[model samples]
Target: MSSATKYTRGHATFNVISKAILAGFATACLLPFILMIIGSFTDNTTVLVNGYSLFPEKWSLAAYELIFKYPKQVIDAYKVTIFVTTVGTAIALTITTISGYALSRPTFRSRNRIALYLYFPSLFGGGLIPWYIMMTQVLKLSDSIWALIIPSLVSTYNIFLVRNFIRTSVPLELFESAKIDGAGELRTFGQIILPLITPVTATVGLFIALGYWNDWFLSNLFITTSSKYSLQYYLYNMLNSSKALQELKAISGDISIEIDLPSETAKLAMAVVATGPIIMLYPFVQRYFVRGLVIGSVKG
Candidate 1:
């Protein structure tokens, strides 16, 4: 009957209720994706007949088989995507962190002006033709993997986020102390600043990785050779070709040839295949990502 016991019970009850609510919302968000995966495994005929039920009458692996039939193409695309994502993320993080740290420093005389210059492009960008000419005719990066990695190497928005995070998260006294201890700029940045802003670093890194992984437009514009296609572009071309084949069959009545086209189920399977590996990365970094966003937003 004590007041303290009642307060503990009430707080515990509220906490449980909150967790249950969040769990429900999470399930709600996840259910459609789960159903999409299950639907992909379901037979194409069953999907056509039943219209995408979670529990279908038949199961098939036709979609996955179709994808892996071109093993060399798929593997090559995977290598390209992995290389671009890894290299792009590393380069992006380095540039963003360095620029951010410099901008966060009070002693940097032109930090504000340089920040404005960086921010300007995000608000106003040159038209597509100019950029295309610049990349192709000027830089001559077409038909190469460099085209994908180079253009998106730096994000002004990410730089500002990191700058704000560093300004608000790290104490000014730490920098002064490091300077007094005879540490050079590089030494202080490497030994002191980098370690302190790990959360934000990981957060920005994840963003850059996702951007690189999901990018297909850049590939469409720059890549002419099939050998250089990224995974997203490969999948996009796969889906488009499949659709075109279906249309050809419908229009030409090509039952004589017996062509096998990818169904709706197959498209869903492609999505799962393309996205599954990248999705696995989120769980490993989810904690830091959430914490980083909270600290960055609240502190800034």
Candidate 2:
């Protein structure tokens, strides 16, 4: 009968309803991935006949077996991708944050001009032929791992996101206070600014990591040696090879070619392998990602 009791009941009902809705949404999001995983394990013939399903009539490891047929190559690709993603993300995050902090500081008189310089390239680019020449002929980065790392190390969009987040979420007075305490720019940034911008940094780091992880074009363009291929590129090559084999079989009309390439299942398997590590990484940064997006999106 009391107002407090009614309020409590209403709040409890809202919580239950909200939780149920979120649960349903989460399940819906996960369903496709779950089916893909299951389909990867299902017999290729069964999958071809039945399409993808939660419950497959027949089970098989043909796809995984084919993928791991050259375990060394797969392992090497994994190593390359992991190293690139880790090192590239760290370096990119450092550069972006530092650039953003510099831009955000009102005392930096040339920030506007510098920002214009950074933003201009993003708007217009010299054609691919020139870019290729610059990388291969000018930089001499061909067949080198650095080729992959250097090209995408800094993103203009990410830099601006961090700059905006710092300007809006962080107070200018804090910088002045640090200066008064005899803190050098480096010391002040490390101790004060870095801590306040954790959410934005994590978000930017995640974006950089994903970009590095998913990048296949860089490897295709710059890398000639098979050993240096990143995971995405390696998988892309494998898929191409599989399709080639299928095409050859179709042309030959030879039922005895014995080319049992699990193309569809192999695709599913590749997705699982390539995405598994990055998917695991999401939960650790999920909270920061959401908070950063909110804080960064608010117009200063």
Candidate 3:
């Protein structure tokens, strides 16, 4: 055989092996989600009781029916989640971008000290009890929607992401040109810096939105009212409500309510529901993350 033929054969074998490894990694990441999604549709219950089955022996829509029975509650949860995700992401991006821009500027004498100040939050947030009391008693924010929105307004990590992107991406000459154009600091930021950082902003915005959408802990703590609960927390309580004595007794007691809730399935389905929009969003937003990082490459 010719040397070229031998080399080609070896390269083809390497590509096949590389593809196989990647497929395995992808499966590892995706299989759980697939199982969870399928389980939601399955008639199966717990791991102890019903083994993991993708398809069901007896197909049932009872889980969905029960979920829909409280349509208003579900809708309200969706509203709260949507509201929090939108508002929180917007506020966070603005704050993070502005902070990042200031930090990225070389002339800012106190930049290092400022960075240290912001970074301190990452290492030394007070205990949860103190933070909760500060929000609830002193601020009188318990059971309020502000309880959910206000605390999540900024993240130290996101600020760093924006700073990194801005430091590397935004050109100093552009800032100088804007100053020469008679643009004030706000104008320079609004017209120049923001437009250029679209990639990172979109990427970070999605991150912020997902964080708010998925969060249930804050709602559990400061929020006591059912109406004010975000979608994730609302679903959390509903998910556990399967074992609630009243729900069980009612399902059994009422002939009119012949609903057989596949509570386990509903939990899975609700998770799928809660995450569906986010999953759809990821592909589009993920495109931004790479392109943004590339656009923001640090120049020497």
Candidate 4:
């Protein structure tokens, strides 16, 4: 065979192998979400009894009916979650951006020390007991929306991401030119840096939004009242109350239990409601996020 033909065949084989590897990785990443979506619709009794099934053999809308029946709880949860996600993302992004920009400035002497002060918390969260006591006894944050907001406002990882992105991407000349034109740091940051960093900002903001939206741990611990539960916490109760029901049944054995628990279908509906907007909006944001990474190449 000719050398040219052999090289062409090798290139074709390499391309095919690369595509197959990428496809496999994509499938691995997507399979869990697909299972969750499918499981939400599958008969829970069947799933509990016979592992997860790809398709629902016995379908029912009972779960959705139950959620709709007590729509007040779900609606309230949505309100709280939306408020938290929006406000939390806004506050987090603002702080992260400002801090990151300040830290990225080469002349800042306290940047490293301040970064350590912020970053150390992520490595070891004060154990729940001490943290809880601090928030509740010391700070009096229990039973308030501030419980969620305050704890999550400053993420060490976010600060680092913003700082690195700013350092690697944002142009120094732009800041210099702005300063030479007599623009103060705050004005330059507000008007110039912020506009240019929208891509990274959007990326970080979306991450914060998702974190707040999907958070159940904070609500579960901090909120004792029904009215204060976020969507994830409320949905969690609706989705997984089977264990509690089982315990109740075991306690009072030999009696027919008829507590209306959320059904598999309703779980699917809830999942859809929870993630629908994010999935819809991600494509738009992703476009810019990609551009941000691409545009912000190495800085000297």
Number of the predicted model whose lDDT against the real structure is largest: 2
In order, candidate lDDTs are 0.86, 0.87, 0.77, 0.79
lDDT of 4 by residue, 116-168 (tens): 99888778776889988999999998899879788789877777777887787
Ranking by TM-score: 1, 2, 3, 4
TM-score of each: 0.85, 0.83, 0.80, 0.80
lDDT of candidate 4 at residue 28, scale 0 to 100 = 97
Pairs clashing within candidate 1? none
Clashing pairs in model 4, backbone N/Cα/C closer than 3 A:
63-263, 64-266
Cα displacement (Å) at residue 22, model 4: 5.5
Candidate 3 at 222: error in angstroms? Answer: 1.4
Q: Residue by residue across 203-242, what tens digits does model 2's lDDT show? A: 8888788889999999999998998999999878877877
Candidate 2 ranges beyond 4 A from true positions? 1-31, 48-53, 254-264
**Residue-wise C-alpha lDDT for candidate 3, range 183-221, written one tens digit per residue:** 987888788888887877887777677779999998998
TM for candidate 2 is 0.83
